[model samples]
Target chain A: MTEAAGTAGPAGSAGAAGVDGPGRPGPRRGRVLEGLRAYGLIAAMWIRSTMAYRTSFVLMTVANFAMTVLDFVAILLMFSQVDALGGWSLAEVAFLYGVSGVSFGLADLAVGSMERLGRRVRDGTLDTLLVRPVPVLAQMAADRFALRRLGRVTQGVLVLVYALVLLDVDWTVAKVLLMPVMLLSGAGIFCAVFVAAAAFQFVAQDASEVANAFTYGGTTMLQYPPTVFAQDLVRGATFVVPLAFVNWLPAGYVLDRPFPLALPEWVAFTPPLVAVACCALAGLAWRAGLRSYRSTGS
Target chain B: MTDGDGAAAGGAAFIELDGVEKVFDVRRKTGFLKRERREVRAVDGLSFTVARGEMVGYIGPNGAGKSTTIKMLTGILTPSGGRLRVAGIDPSRERTRLAHRIGVVFGQRTTLWWDLPLIDSYRLMHRMYRIPDARYRENLDRCVELLQLAELLEVPVRQLSLGQRMRGDIAAALLHDPDVLYLDEPTIGLDVVSKAKVRGFLRDVNAERGTTVLLTTHDLQDIEQLCSRVMVIDHGRLMYDGPLAGLHEVGESERTLVVDLERELPPVEAPAPARVVRVEGPRQWLAFPASASAAGLVAAIAARYPLVDLSVREPDIEAVIAKMYAERASA
Candidate 1:
């Protein structure tokens, strides 16, 4: 698609379109819609770019699925040796594992690029995002959109569906409806943690591996019932990082299991609220990080 | 130029800075037990105004804070103190708002996605910037034809040559039709042909679009070919700001005259202002003030010796800068 642009000699000739009296500020579209469109376009471009190497992408996806399945295999092997661990049956723990796995995989799909913020900061490439006309957060999310994460998410959802069909619990309508909310809000919570981790890079000026302890480690911990953990460790995950709000508590409510640590039943429903608060706090930390970035650009 | 109005009084300033200062507090560990904190002033009291439609060159040695100033202008780094306004908007405070009006290219790094095809990056920009479809197409078509990038559009950025990637980056920056373009060392690692192509493209962009440009490059030829105004900074201070011609005079630079004599002889006795600095075989080299008229020296040498052929050489900017730095240090 080509049109003869003014093609005026190598000197200033005001082009009619694009250039005019005072730039016209390019049509002020609705901010949310603009962000969404830009994000979608970025993700599409990333997918296309990945698809360029179709075989590699496919292999990586398959490998991710296989690797995640091994986790379930290990759990199954352990369950074979014993009927139950910490009073929860193997099938019940699989539900917990599936929910946390899906939530984490989904969040990784959205915000995994935050994990590389340290490298971008160290190399000064983050400046490219800063110069663009979009929010840095949206740009960061778009910068690294991995389709391979879907493999793990698919594995997780499959495990979850299988667990649901086989479990003897009476499936309530509320349980069915809240399952999706749990997954989405759980993803939101993980995404918030990722953003908060990115904020740490501004101070460290390098990739902070510490964030993985919560993001990946929290998901691993949630794969088992909190009752299996030491009291202090369970409390920390529940109250300190609120990892329990992501899946364990919600899964407990759905499975009709008693809450660990003497928590009320309402806490299970607070994933959405907790997720929102976490997002707000992450946003504040992200802003503070940006401020520090602008001040001390290292 | 079509931008004669911008040069006149009462014209709107496209970029303005007043006493801008950026001080970095660096903490270094002296040992396991002790550390030291010191404030390194990167840019101190930097003040300049760029008029609309002006293509200006910003030059400085390493660590002279050229990149820091560019960062501040782009709002990537905020100044420690002072006020800065680009198109009447404070850059750091209204960075996202200002982003729509400005385009930046960092020659050392790319803004393009690494794995995407060259055209894919441009396509992403079309949406990211919300560029009108018609405008995006027109700009892309122009850049492709002018940059000779049609064959490279489908190539992944990682596979592209540095020069090709640089051209792609320039095209990406312009697709949005930004009002101002900041190019930091745009020709840093490019070959001669690529440099010429880039310089010509920049000249066209500046002239046709009236995009106010502030170019920072180590390549003096980039400034010589494209910029009418040059600003030189040293030690976070404006050492010189004027025409490229005036830089040699400020640096107290000396031009060399290479004369081919018919035969090897003793050092040729030239006039008072010009003296033979080197003699080898039939070639005699003389040093003269860069500001002095070379015509008289040529005539004087021609009369004194059997001059086979003679060529006047402008002082290379590298030597000019070295001399300037030496003088600045001694002062």
Candidate 2:
């Protein structure tokens, strides 16, 4: 192997980059761009691989679409018994559900591979990721991009459009701009939650259902108006987990509805801040998780 | 005995470890409510060095910290205590940086994407490692040719046979032209042909490319055929580190001399301590200590018996190591 290394060394030195020199820091911007490009290539490969099985891909997408639609149907059935619940109309509830759905779906598509980290760790495959130069999170995400989540995304968009058409809200530029912000930041929050769930595997040796209680259960709870829940539960979700920022708070501004619990109107626009905070916390948790994993490697 | 240029220039081993140790804290459930905690020292104060371009074999029985040492070398697991360096870089502190210089293959599980074609995994690695296009192409072409992977490149990794997949994995590890390659059981579960192919490629890559190799294997033949230097590890300790021939003497193994007598005869009266261990018609087998000179016994046998032909057999590595282990246990 050293003969190849000896020959390859001169070839590598002859190249423009001059091979990983110590303390050279080789163009930070270029490295970031290269990392992004590598991630893109990996993502493309994953898409191609998933596309290899067209029938399964389509079936999974359809199955995902049908499964989420049943939740919407259940909500509709509940509305059939009463004109409105929690002082919000059916369209208003759809608005909340739609936003949460779209954001969660997009986040699921982006970083859902975090859910499989526990399995990978258990099977000793995570060692492969650590060997790579790129960040393990990026590798895991790029390894499995869930295009099937488009099912939930499409349903969210359709429901959101229907709600916008049905409700006559005072459409303002600020409110319109906030829609994407809400969706993206909500997605950011969900992505952070997914990352946190993955980080737990390093601590617990396997992904725990406690993370699901916050992610899946939290998303299910977010689809409804916070007004319907007990004040304490609402407060906990607002302060403890901040799921309110993902849907409840933003829905108030989007629907031109009064803030629940007589909270300040400014709370309706704090999803981006909450999302950023969640991401920061998740990053810290992930780093600690990686440290523990390296030390113990359970 | 020929030191490669890298070791000559640097005047140091490419890999170095001093008093390395790895301890694991494990808790076991003894009963429904009882739990016990214990510290398992997987690697204990072990030390060895491999010069640049040296193909050294690391051999040990299961649970003897072979895999753990490899993991620590690759920075997948941090050592609990010791001084270690690969190419002057601390692996755990600068793992990603070190990744550019080192390549590793774990024979039991693949690093390649199982659902993707073999080439797809290589392509991803090309990007991931930031290999220059020309270099990537050159290395990929070389490995594909040498490993006979042209037909297997398009096959999904999951569909490849174990041997084919192992070959593909070896190629993948070398495609980046890493300075040092760590192979943990690279030929595990491989058939004879596949194993031979892998060994041949490994030899070429080491000799022609001057790439340093640290191979861990259970197959004694792997060590005998490829490694000029071999390290024997047991119970997380370096039991022996020397040439393959030295191991025979250390284990007190025996060399076999099969003598073909001119006719069917009683077991020839052999020299003391060189008595015949087996007899069949006209042939007799003599077992003598491997460290003893074969000339004295052969001359004595020839002077007394009508010997038509005789051949001396070197001690078997398997028996030597097994005896070594038994001796260690008894000691």
Candidate 3:
């Protein structure tokens, strides 16, 4: 029965269908472009869906902006009472806060919906993503693509501009260049933390809270100088989780302040390296998580 | 392609599985802070080859490995053992590549974005699959017309009925012109009209486009109407594989011959092995092997007894499958 049908089947139509034959190597650049296009398409669809309810979208964005502003206000209140925090002037600390806040906000904007990975895993939505021609991480990252989170990023940028005007610094060509690099690498580090933490959901299925502690908590800790925290805690953050590269170590260099742990100034220039290493490790964790995914029974 | 066994043999087997197994490590909490780990072989030593364009029914009891096999075929889950391929691509290894050629729909889940209009989902799929504009338009038009999705295009998926949502999903799967479609219970919760519509559309797709379909459904009529060949799986093993009629014979099933006799007189003398199993008033029912010829038995009954009317009822595929599972359990 199969042979009779096979004689009149998809062999001729396969070409007409425009599917690349098995193992046919399409141009690598073309494949990457296709993946990016798919990601952008999904992200746009989600943004449109969010905009469908205009009132709610506006209210949510405003509420997010208001809520994040309070975080910086608390820092302001702290400086009003004490002349400085951990022996750093209010401007220097504000610089660190702005750096951490902007990077975390950007990371949150990009991958915040990944916090729902555990729920997706439990509900089998992850399976739907796996069958798509696009990369799974790209799909997950763009799953809901919340635009409301941009409010936090906006707040961070405003605070950062405020600190840049307030601080008196000797800016070299390298220091000037390091400013954007620090923010981007800091965001990259936080993005990797989000992905790696969410990957654990494939096994535990309800560990989103555990992931939030690292992502949100790391940003909160980075806002204040590491000098305020105990030495051992600072060491763990630096060597283990590498949250220090996010802003603390680099901000010290930018402010020309002494290192908290009396570490070398050279260590302050390593955010990019740390970000790359964290991302590579996160990539492996995500791959391993996908391979270990036992999709829920139908 | 390096595993060149069947790829060289005319490429007949578009979907092939050889001793494919999926063993899940299920952990159970036996007590407080105590857990036990056990291996549950969802698919055990299963082997089957589906030639291109074959709309085969893959029926099995719940938790009998139907979904697991589909997951493995789609590369959602890797097989613990054995070789499996779809269109000569190792699914788990080149899942994204193979995904360009295969479309899958899970009845219990909607791949369409819930808050978006039905057409929006199709539009997203157009870019996601990188489908050619002309071909996407053609396939979309065909599916819309056949599945009666024109009215539901603008409606949000959350607002559509279950049947309407199901049609939308089927159309979404086809817009890319996939070479194969895996439908897990496509007719699951649909009304009679919707089921018929889906079955007709699938038949046309297979006949016209020659899209190989592996449908797993509980609705036996789905197989009766759409598939010429059916496979019955139980306990991760293929118990039966042949024409739907042959399934009854494998189960040793019997077809009932209900006869309305002229004032039932002592259970009309039926032929050997076709004895009356029940007699009520003037109606008498006889049991005959489903594989037997009912014409000869009907003739003998009419010749001797005053038979007013008679009808031969084909064995129920559902019952035949249940008996197949029962027999396997006992053996």
Candidate 4:
């Protein structure tokens, strides 16, 4: 192409220079970088999209923030009356709740596009994405980002900090460093569940709401001990869906409390594993779904 | 083994097919038996190809595999029986790789971010294509200037005029500077000026970049103005494949001549071999063969009545294509 050969200076020179590099993996690296750049570009577009309807966005976001805070206040009032249920204090319950909240908020940011994106796939609008040189997943991620969700994440951070101050927990350098790890892992776990719920859309005609169990249900379940439920169904859902690892299991470490199960102490330290395993499974499900993509009409 | 050498379904040739088929399973109910699956052959054993750098006008009434063929060529769809390849890579196999080299525009849609400004989409394309910063700026400047997108760049795409949006879509397709471009009705809903501008842009993109372009549209003017070769498809079959000149060559030459007479003419036939088309008031229109017999038809009309004025017109592409389709219909 003339443009490829036409550019001068650094960006062009770097590309040409890499053509004869000593080893391989160069082209793919370029694509990966392109993917990241594409995502950033669309995110900016999303911000502009929000800016277009500034008043509606601001009003709706404020309402959402108010509702989130209201829910937390309701939990606090209920706990004040009962003192403690399922062996968790008000502070401990809040800690688990905050972790789950923040994780789901981050997950919503990363993969929220998937929910409505399935419609694009069904309507054949995804043809625009499939023809691009970038990875479909990257294209899908950048396809459409809803910026108003930031309101929920802000609420999550507020509750998380409150729980940390109210609880009696020993904080160390390693634990502080691992805080980001826990957040990312928790996000990964929830994102996987959301994506899997979206994948069912490939087969279903309507928007698949099954992901609510893992996303909404999972978040609510993690706020307390998994064993608190009388039926094993809730416990099974937590382990199978790995809500325990992302929130409940991690809460055990932060609270330094014994779990209902007689498993070893180290077993409670498994947030990263559960998060990663759920993510890997979801990713595989996504690829399979693409193979079965039946683009409608032309 | 061939359309002469045996045509494969959709693999061996540049655009091949071997019983290339598609069956869509539509499920209306919830249970297993409630699901009803039916086979719709959008492209039933359809097969054809345009060699490198060839400009082919793929035509069909509608849903006769025109888009299906393009989609298969672009690797968006995998044929039930055949394989597809473009630029030496199986489109389905190297879909991501092929994307870098091919450009496509959907006539009824815009590939751009819906709510973003035109320039923003261009900037994102610069990133997606990894255009060097300098080159990005240079190409951006050129396309904006060429497409008259400067004023339109600041406005959001949702707020763009239809003509303006078509220009933006075309500019976006060429941003990466692809080797192949697919246009599905690129000029469907544009004004004459916008359509001409789009056609002109496509012609230059082909000539300047030697980009092999495959376009489908209902506008015959597009074919007349841009494409040197036209391929017509009807009912999922290649009805005609040749040059535009060939389409105009209808086995015999015909020209139309109109004359106004000062007085009514007596009953008279054409002097030599011309045939009278119609007569209204003082004017008479005649169809004459290309054998230089218009003078004879005129002299005969003049002999019967005093002539006021006369002129001859060459057959336009619209009439030529209509006649061609009609002849094909009866034959």
DockQ of predictions, in order shown: 0.33, 0.32, 0.30, 0.26
Model 4 chain B: worst 10 consecutive residues (lDDT sum): B1-10
Each model's C-alpha lDDT?
Answer: 0.84, 0.82, 0.84, 0.70
TM-score against truth, every candidate: 0.92, 0.89, 0.90, 0.81
Candidate 3 C-alpha lDDT tens digits along B161-258: 99889989999999988878999999998999989989999999999999999999999999999999998887788888889888877888899999
How does model 3 score by TM-score? Answer: 0.90
Best by DockQ: 1
What CAPRI class is candidate 3? acceptable
Model 4 C-alpha lDDT per residue in residues A255-278, reported as the tens digit of each score: 777754544666555668877788
lDDT per residue for candidate 1 within B90-144, as digits (tens), equals 5675566567779999998898878878988898888777788999999999999
Instruction: Give model 4's DockQ, 2 decimals.
Output: 0.26
Summarize candidate 1's per-residue lDDT along A62-167 as a digit string, tens digits.
9999999998899999988999889999889989989999999999988887888888888888988888766677777777688998998999999898788779
Q: Give lDDT tens digits, candidate 3, residues A183-206.
A: 999999999999999888877789
lDDT per residue (tens digit) for residues B1-331 in model 4: 1121111222333444445555445545668667655666666665566566667787656766788777777767766665445655556544655566688999987987677788888877887676678866776777787788889998889999888998898888888777778999999989989998888878877887777888998888788788888877655566667887676565354778888878666434666467777888777787776546577677777786777999997656556655656777798
| Candidate 2 regions with alpha-carbon error over 4 angstroms | A1-35, B1-11, B257-269, B275-286, B293-313
RMSD values, in order shown: 6.5, 5.5, 5.4, 6.6
- Per-candidate iRMSD: 11.1, 9.0, 9.8, 11.7
